[model samples]
Each structure stands twice: as structure tokens, then as C-alpha cells.
Target chain A: MFRIAIEMLLYDKTKYIGLLIGVAFTAFLVTFAMGYFAGFMTRGFALVSENPSAKVWVMDPSVSSAEATINMSDSALDIVRGVKGVNYAAPMYLGNMTARYANGDFQTFQAIGVDDATLSGAPKPANLLRIPESAIVDSGGTEGKLQTPIYKKDMWSYDGSHLNAPTRKLRYGDTMLINSKRVVVAGVSHTIPRFPPRPLLYTTASNFKRLVPGEKRYITFIMVRPTKNITPNKLAKRIAKQTGLKAITSDEFKKETVLWYMINSEDVGDMVNMVILAMLVGFGVTGVMLYMFTYENIKQYAVLKAMGASTKQLSDMIFTQVFISAIIGSGIGVGIAAILAHMVSSATFPFRMMWFAPLIGFLGVIIVSMTAAFISLRPIKKMEPGIVFKL
Target chain B: MSKIISTCRDIVKNFNSGEAEVKALQGITLDVYENELLMLVGPSGCGKTTFVSVLSGLLSFDSGVCKLMGEDISTMSDERLTAFRGKNIGFVFQAFNLLPSLSAIENVALPLTVEKRKRVETLTLSKEMLEAVGLDGKENVKPSGLSGGEQQRVAIARALVHNPKFIICDEPTSSLDHKSGQIVMELLTEIIKEKGASMIVVTHDNRIYKYADRIVHMEDGRIVKVAS
Candidate 1:
């Protein structure tokens, strides 16, 4: 019976191919949309995820996400360090600053600052530790962009890998001006980019203060690590009570960042809407095509019924048809999605196909196909076997 | 000479076509004997097809009994009817109704598949049936590629592949040329005799009348006469 169902579906070449395409396109749309959403979420929480050793983060009461941080007074670091369960705490400075290149092109970079002594928040590099009065540039996607020339075509020596290159350039200490002060380029780090793509530059807190001298006690956050016996959430609560500041566990801060973006940014809202629209279009096309296919094959179904095929047998045949379509279509969709993910991984855009995205999309297509199958089954159920005798 | 394979008495069916009651089968009484070729013949809308439908368990009659192999078709549950039909009855159609994606052997293997038989065994039997119907070497050909006569041969093999007790054919050769029609009729009769199965062949082609053991004519939803 399954053989017959498949054969019947394949009998009409045009309809069979059209049905497969419908299912495949739907699967593609679902996976791609979910993949994009996954990328956004990863970028939103990347800062917290990058420093896996940090247990908790201390910031001003208004700080919600990496991008929504408010400057905390430098004194907050000593206060957090004094609280119980604190193994060590250091100030992490972050700010958006325009960097003027050697060729006079100015671009915005997320300047991430760590204390000179500990190098807590910055990307750890062997060459960075060796070089003095120099900064690390994140080159995740700088092949052709503003920072590409600085790290690629310039006089820099290639060192470590591209994501974590161990090289430097600055013929006789080349420098770039950020607020009228020249800073040396030491090395490049291949850290993942944030959602709202901005180039990253790693520097010391002292250099950060040197670049922006207006704020005397500028400390964006104080990253903390708990002792062996204490949990981060418990330590965070104790610190917040002692310093009258918002001390949150890294997980809480990560969630807050994603929520803040979802609520406050129109672009984030648009992305979510796009995902939903893809789902609607995918399901809609598959449903209509399957229904039309079933309608066209009503006579064949009647013939089968007249031949004494049990209702269960007939139902299984229909379900099997849809099941096969969904599986094949989903395989193609996931394959294309993986290829798409690979294509944009090197670009400046934040695109990621998470482990669960494709699985979810595949399951979603199955559900849609099943629904379409039921819709197609209604007409078959009502078909009269007497039609087979019609001239 | 043989036991009764199917019997219908005072079978009636009606349809409501736009406020008018159309009596498609006013009263149909028929009996098919084992190993007999019974042809139901009539003009258009004469209930010949309806009588065949009821006899084959594909149609229901109003307030009448239809018994196949001494079991009442109306008294059986839907599932029982389907199982009975799949196991005991075979059907052929005017269009040949050969699935285009399946080869001749696969179409013949359908009844066994419905019976949940193993694929290898069903195909082996289907191949033999096709060969018996003079479709040798054509088992792998799809219906689309086969000529009208070959397609009808495949259809007959499909109908009889399970060795059902009865076979039903609806205008089995209406679309064929006279030569192909005669060939199909000969093959159908020979195969029925070989299987010892009763058959109800509803057809308008008069050229195949000679193959029938008995012929019943219908007109205006009633049996007009029996010709032998």
C-alpha cells in the first residue's frame, strides 16, 4: 500500500516534484530563520560567555546587558572584593570610541579594557603580554573592512592564527589616534563579534582613561570570581547588599541582555517578525500543495477503496506519503542550511546555526506535513467507491 | 454445476439529484456461480454497473441482502467488509487503473501487499501471474509504456493475483481495439477458468459476449432478461 501511495504520488511527475519542493522550501525557511535567531542570541550573550571563569559581574544598578551598561565608580571594585566569597575582582572598562586609521578612515570600535596588572577582561595573548604600550584588535571579520588594512595589508608581522594571531605591526611603533591620542597596535584577537557588529579593540584601563579623560572614575563593570565553596548567585546577592549596587550572576546578565535587545530595539523586533513570517509562508505553501495533490488523486483513492483497502491501510498510505516527503525535504533543508551557515561564518554578519535549530526545523516540518496530510485525507474519507463504475 | 459464489436479492439503491429521487437500482437480483463468466450488459444508466458494484461489495443496497460466499455483505462491519473484499474479491476497471509509477509486476502484487504479504513472495507470485496472462518479459514495464492490451493483461493479473474467489471487471476493454479486446477477453476467461473463480464482467463491448457463460441485460434500473 505504501508502495502504491508513493507510486501514485510519483505518477504525475509535475505534481510530485512540486510537492517535494513545497516541503523542502518550508524546511529551508524554518531552519534559516531559526538559525538567524540563534545567532542573535549568541551575540547578545557573547560578552558574558567569553569570560567563562567569571562567576558574577558587578555594575551600576541600571546596567542590564553588555551594550546597556552604565559606568560604575572605581570604588565599587574594592567594595565588591571585600565582600565574602570573593576570590578576586577586577574592573572591566568598556566604551564605544571612534578610531582614526593611518589612512584617515574613522570607524567605531568597542574598546574593551582590563587592568594592566591582571589582564582579566581582555583576550589573553602571549605577544600582548610581551609588548608594552600596545593594544589587541579583534579581527574576526576584518578581511576587507576598516580594520582589515591595519591587520592585513599593513607592515604587521603574522604570528598566531587569524582568530588569535600572534603578530604586530607599526613600523617603528605605528599608532592610531583615538581622541587625539596615538595608541600602538600590538596584536589581533579572533574573538567572536557582537550582534550589532562593531570592531573590538583590547586595551588597558589606564590607556582607556588616557583616551577618554573626561570621566575620572570610569569603570563599566567589575568581574568577580567566587571561592570554591560559594555559588555565584549567592555571592552576587551578598555583594549587592553590601555595596548598594546591582551585582548579578553571569547567567542573569546574559538573559537581561537578550531581553533588553528584544524589548528596546526595533531591529531585534524586525528579526523576530521575520522568523515568524518564514514559518507562516513555509507551512502555507506545503499545506496547499499537499492538499492540491490529494484532491487531484481522489479518483485513485476511490479505486483503492473499491479494491477493499481497509481504512487503516488507506490512512497509513497517506500518512506514509507525507512522512516521506517531510523527511526528504527536511534533509535537503538542513543540508542547505548548513551550507548557508558555512558561507556567512567568515563575514562580518553574526550568523549561527545552533545545534538545536535544524532539529527543531525538521520537527516543525513534520508537524506541518502531518497537518497537510490530514487536510488531504478528508476528501478521501468522503469519496464514494461507486465512482469507480462511472464511465 | 458449481456452488454459488455471490447472490443478491431485491437489491435497491436511490439518489437524490436536485429534489428528484433518481432510482439508480430499483430491484437487482443476480447470482454468480463458481468458474462462471457472468457479463452484466445494458445501455447507459441501466443499473448494470450498480448491480456489479453491489455484487463486488463496493456499493450498498437498500433493504436487501448481498451474500458473497454465503456471508452477508451488509451484516459485516466496515473493517470486516474490507478484509473480506481484499481476501476474496478482485476488481478490474475500464481505465485499466494501472498505477503509472509501478511496473506491471508491482501492480499485480497490490492485493498481496494489502494482505501484508512479504514483498519477495508477492513479487514472485505476481511475476508468475503476469507470465500466465501472456505478459512474459513485460513485468518491469510501467502501464504508461505498455499497449492497451498489455495494460489490460496487467490489470487482470492484479485482480486475480490473490486467487480470490470472485473477480469483478468494469468495461475491461472499452478503450481497446477489437483485436486487443478479443485478446483480453480470451485471456480473462482462460485465467478465470484456471483459477475456478466466478466473475462479473460489466462491459458494453459486444464482441466479447461469446466468452460469457451467461449474460444478464438491464434497462431503466431493472433486469430486462437473461441471455445464454
Candidate 2:
């Protein structure tokens, strides 16, 4: 009976191929859309997430997410460092600066100013201190997420693929103007994009102060690492009480950022819409194609039924075809999405590929195929086995 | 004297399409014994097909005692009746009814496949049956690739592949030429004798009446004449 199901599916080459294509299309569309949305989730907390050194973040009392908050007083850095469980607190200048490239292209970037003494909240590779006039430009900016190909004056462009290709390494002398102040590129940091999709620039706190002169309250997020034997949650509560500010653990802050983006970002809603629409398209294709194919083969089912095939046997045949198609179609869809994730990530569009995103798409195909087969079974059940004697 | 394999006593069946009700089978009483070929012949709408449907458990009788090997198929559940039919009955159709996508042997192996037979064994037996029907080298040919006579030969191979105790063929040779019709009848009758199986064949192909152990004629919705 299983063999009959498979052979019958393969019997009509046109219908079989059509069914496969419909399933594959469903898989591909759903996976790619959800993957792109997953990328948005990464972008929502790009700033605080990359700096793993910071265990707790202090923000305005009313601020729920990272970007939605007002700037903190520069003196808040000292106030947070005085908390009981605090090991060290750093003042992070989270502000945007207009960068004029050597090629005269002006772009906006998340200009992050790290603590000059401890350099507490800056991200890897910890060598920004080695280069003179040192600053790192974010390379993970593409698809209008930020600047395209953050180029340096002397270094060759990094437009190639794979390990053997030339790396996007920056030379010591390549410089860009930050508000007309000379700022040189020492390295490039690959960070998950920001909510507003801005490129990132990492510089010392003094350089940030020089670049954006005379901002009265330059400090934005007060990043703190808790001392050993103290969890970030306890420290956050204490800091919130003592400082009269909102202090949250890193995970809570990340969750708040994600939730804030989910509610406020129109792009997130649009991405979600694409996922829903793709599912409908997939279901539509699968349902209509299977219905037409089964209708054409209804008589064949009648003949088989008359020849002593039970309803279970016939149903198994149809479902077997559907199950096989679902597996193969999902494989094709996830495979393409994975490949696209790799390619688009290099160019710095936030295309994220989680293991479960494709699984969701796979489940979608299964539901679609099963429902379609169920709808098709109505005709199979209603068919009279005695009709085999006619025609 | 052969043992009785199937018995249908005064079976009644009707079909209703809107307000008009047609008596498709009216008081059909018949008996098919082991190792016998019982042929039912009649004009269009004469209840021959309907009677055979009732006997094979493909259709329900309003009131009658219809039994296959004394199992009382008329009283069996739909699942039980279908299982019984798969185990004890095989059918060949007038149009050959071969799935267009499958090759000759695949169609022949279908009945056994439905019964959950092993693939290798089913295919091997199907090949043997196709060869028995003189379709030896054409095992992989689709029904469309075969002649009308060859298609009917494949249908016969399918019918016997499960080795059912009783075979029902509705006009199995009516669409074949005279020579092909004679060949099909000979193959069916010889295989029945070889296996000691009972057969109920409904046909209007008088050219092959010589092959029947007994011939029953139907008219309107009742058996009018039986010729032995």
C-alpha cells in the first residue's frame, strides 16, 4: 500500500512535480521571512548584547528599552559604582555621530565611548589601545541597515567569500572625520545592527568627548559588572533603590529591548506579516494542487477499492506521498535559507538563521500537506467501489 | 461434485436518484461452487453487474442471505467485508482499468501490495503471472503502451496475483477482438482449473460461452434463464 501510494504519486509526473514545487515554495518563503525577522530580534539589542562584560545596565526610570530611554547624567557613573555589589561601573557614551569618510561619504554610526581608565564596556578583540588615533568601524552593515562596506583609505575592500579571500583588515593610517574631527580606523567590529540600523564606531571616552564637544550629559547607559558572589539581579535592585533610576540585569534589559521592538517597530510587524502571508500562500498552493491531482486519480482509487483495498490502505497511500513531499520540501527550503544567511551576513544585512525557524516552516508544510490530503479524502471516501465495473 | 463457495438467496437492492427508484437487483438467488466458472450475461441495465456486486460484497442487499465460503458477507461490517473480499475475491474489469502510470507488472502486483505482501516476493510473483498471461518481456510497459488485448491480459494477471479463491470479472473480454477474447477466456478458465478456484464472469461476448461451466442470463432486474 505504501508502494502504491508512492508509485501513484510518481505515476503522474506533472502532478507530482507540481506538488513538490508547491511544498518547496512554501518552505522557502516561510523560512526566509522568519529568518529575516529573527535578524530583527538580534538588531534590537545589538549595543548591550555584544559587550558581554557589562552584567547590569542603569537607565532612566521610565525607559523600558535601550534606545527609547533618555540620556543619564554623567555623574550617574559614580553613583552606580558606589553600589554595594558593584565590582566596577563604567560610563558608556551611546550617541550617534556623523562620520565623513576619506571618500567624502557621510554616514551616521553609533559612536560608543568606553571608559578611559578600565575600558570596561568595549567589545573584542581588546587591541583598540594598541593603534594610534584608534577607532573600530562596524562591518556588519548592509541593506540600508547602515553604511555599505565601511571602507578604509589604504586597505583593500573585503568583497570576497570564504577563508582564502582577503580579510577586511584596516591599516593604521586610514582616517575618517567625526564631526570634522580626525578619527582613524584601527580595526572593524562586527556587531548585530542597532534598532535604527546604524553603523557602529568604538573610540575612547576622551575621543568621543572630543568628537561630540560640549554635550552637557554625554553618558547614556551606565554599564556595571557585579562583584563575585553577587548576582546582577540583586545589584540591579539595590542600584535602582539607591540611585532612583531603573537598573536591570543584562537578560532583563535584553528582553525589554526585544519586547519594546516587537510592540513599537513597524518593520517587525511587517516581517511577521510576511511569515503569515507565506504560510497562506503555501497552504493555498498545496491544497489546490493536491485537490486537482486527487480528483484526476479518484477513479484509480475507486478501482483499487473495488479490488479489495480498504479505506486505511488508500488513506495511507495519500499521506505517505504528503509526508515524503514535506520532508524533501522543507530540506530544500531550509538549505536555501541557510545558504542565504551565510551570504547575506557577510554583506551585513541582519539575516538570522535559528535552528527552530526552519523547523517552524517544516511544520507548516506538514500541516498544509496533511490538511490538503484530508480534504482530498472526502472524494475518495464518497466514491462507490462498484463504479469500477463502469467506465 | 464440487463444494459450494458462494450462495446468494433472493437478494434485493435498489438505487434512488431523487424521486425515481430503480430496482437494480430484484430477488437474485444464485450459487457458485468450487472449481466452476459461472458466467452472467445480459443486455445493458439488466441487473447483471448489480447482482455480481451484491455477491462479491461490494454492494449491500436489502434482504437476502449472501455468503462467501459460509461467512455471511451481507451481515459483516464494512471493514470485515472489505478484508474478506481482499482475502477471498479478485476482480477484473471490462475496461482493463489499469493505472496509466504503472507498468504491466506493477498493476499485477497491486492486489498483493494492498494485502501488505513483501515487495520482492510480490514483484517476483507478479512477473510470473504476467508471463503466464504471455506478457513476459512487457512487464514494465504501461497500459497505454499495450494493445487492448494485452491490457486485458494484464488485468487478468492482477486478478489472480493474490491467489483469491473466487474471481469476478465483468466483461473481461468484451473490448478485445475475437481472437484476443478467446485467448483471455482460455487463460482465465485454464488458470481457474489449475488453482481449483471458483469464478463468476459477467460477459456478453458469446464467442467465449464455450469456456463457461454454466451460463445464467439476466433481464430487467432478475435472473430469467440458466443454461448449462
Question: Which runs of model 1 end up more than 4 angstroms from their true locations?
Answer: A2-18, A49-53, A60-62, A94-113, A123-191, A198-217, A227-252, B1-5, B20-22, B33-35, B61-64, B118-124
Local error of candidate 2 at residue A299 (angstroms): 3.6
C-alpha TM-score for every candidate: 0.82, 0.79
Candidate 1, residue B175: lDDT: 85
For every prediction, compared with the true complex, DockQ reads: 0.48, 0.53
For candidate 1, write residues B82-166 as lDDT tens digits: 7888899888889888767789998898888878898899989999999999999998898889998889889999999999989
In model 2, which regions exceed 4 Å deviation? A71-76, A93-192, A198-219, A226-252, A291-295, B1-4, B9-12, B20-23, B61-65, B99-106, B117-128, B136-145
DockQ of 2: 0.53
Tell me the whole-model lDDT of each prediction, alpha carbons only: 0.82, 0.82
lDDT of 2 by residue, A47-117 (tens): 77887888999887888987676777888888888889999888888788887654444677777888887
CA shift of A29, model 2, Å? 0.9
lDDT of 1 by residue, A125-171 (tens): 72473366577776533443344244554323344223342233333
Q: Top model by TM-score, which number? A: 1
